[model samples]
Target: MSFSRIAFTVTAFFLTTSALTHAEEGKFTASPGLQLYSLRSQFKLKGVSRTLDTVKSFGIQLVELAGTHEMPIPEFKKELESRGLKAVSAHYPYKRWQTEPDAVAQEAKELGLEYAGCAWADHKSPMDEAQAREIAATFNQAGAALAKVGIKFFYHLHGFEYQPWKKGETLADLIIQETNPEQVKFQMDTLWVVFPGQDPVKLLEKYPNRWDLMHLKDLKQGVATGSLSGQTDVNNDVTLGTGQMNWAAILATAQKVGVKYYFIEDESSSSESQIPKSVKFLQSIRW
Candidate 1:
């Protein structure tokens, strides 16, 4: 056989194998992940090692962090690597983003993280235009700084942003419009969005490119919403398939909108039991 013919045959064989592998599992299978903050209380009491072991046992190699539990950056990264865990993104305090964004970005790089962001911003309930603009400025500053160091920065939404702040506009609208999309991205926390009587699917449709990550949370049925409190009962968190979220539609929309990571964040007392179930739920979802 000619060399070109042999090469073509080998390439065709691998392509066929690849196509079969993808056909077996459709395009939307959920990958296993964890938001380390799900075990924040336990980590505070038992130390990072215990919580990390628990995370690994759940088979979640990717994580979104809340803090280091006082461990140094290098030591924490080493621990994650040792346990087969990878840090996809880490949330720093809002103040840290404001005061020392460069250091935060540098640390994310050192930890081998792909993204860095803030979970919440300081704002009064019924967020005024001034406050919205102020937070947008902070995001602009931090996002630009992180971008300079090769790390993407994002803002995680709390439920409060969904409250009406103007005529047909929520405070989130302000943040969306004010911040430069190239510099700042968003992560939709499903529970937080649902907790506020907002639809995650709609948000994804509205600003397709603005969101790039997700905290794949779910809420218990019959929970009251339209809240601007930004605080909620931890018990409201439920297993992925058993909650108020429409996982299929949301996941489909997320894929369309270019969300890159999905981290399960269970903030209830039963996370030990729920994480496994959530992973199974994601693995089983089709479409």
Candidate 2:
């Protein structure tokens, strides 16, 4: 072969290989979706259309919903679709799941959701074993019903379930043990796990495959933890890497345990300003 032709062929091969490598890295390094509840105040103050525009401005294409901002379900779904946003999961009130799970499933289908969840268990303060068991039964029933409709069910831990139980186990442990894994799954809100003084990495290791989703939130540094109240000032939420979380360790464990979806959920009043920063941080993570 002519020397010039050999050189051209080699350069073309290297160029194609480099392009493929970068494409794969981009797929791996892309940031997770935003939880729409992060902008609850904006939705209320600026109206749904404007608030969603702000979300689209962040270059996010996937989202998790808390509610539809009172829009009809089909209308809300259409709005999301128009902006190239997909709703992978949504949270419904616990009562709605208990009283009318089929209705919840119907609405979830209308929104084209993959998973439906409850963010809080609605139990008395300092949640006890009985309350935890009751919550488990509700989840099991709702999960079964939702499963038939091709929607999975999940529970978002709210910190209060960390209350102590016998043999050094938590009420949270009891609930996990009682629920049917085939039907029920869990979402770990990083802030809630940290706020209640629990180790997210340890939990991920302790219960692999049961946690199907994650809320990528961070807690402000130097704040007190170990509260079982499951409540905190919304302002304690900070941008992803600017907070107290050891994100590398937590995310590594999450990936190892097969956690499927992640959403950046910043509930601070400053969410509008903070979300883009969070997205940048997530994109910078290598592992």
TM-score of 1: 0.88
**Model 1 weakest 10-residue run by lDDT:** 23-32
* lDDT, each prediction: 0.88, 0.91
Best candidate per TM-score, number?
Answer: 2
- Which ranges of candidate 1 are over 4 A from the true structure? 1-27
The 10 consecutive residues of candidate 2 with the worst lDDT sum are 22-31
Candidate 1 local lDDT, residue 57 = 89
Count of backbone clashes, every candidate in sequence: 0, 0
lDDT of 2: 0.91
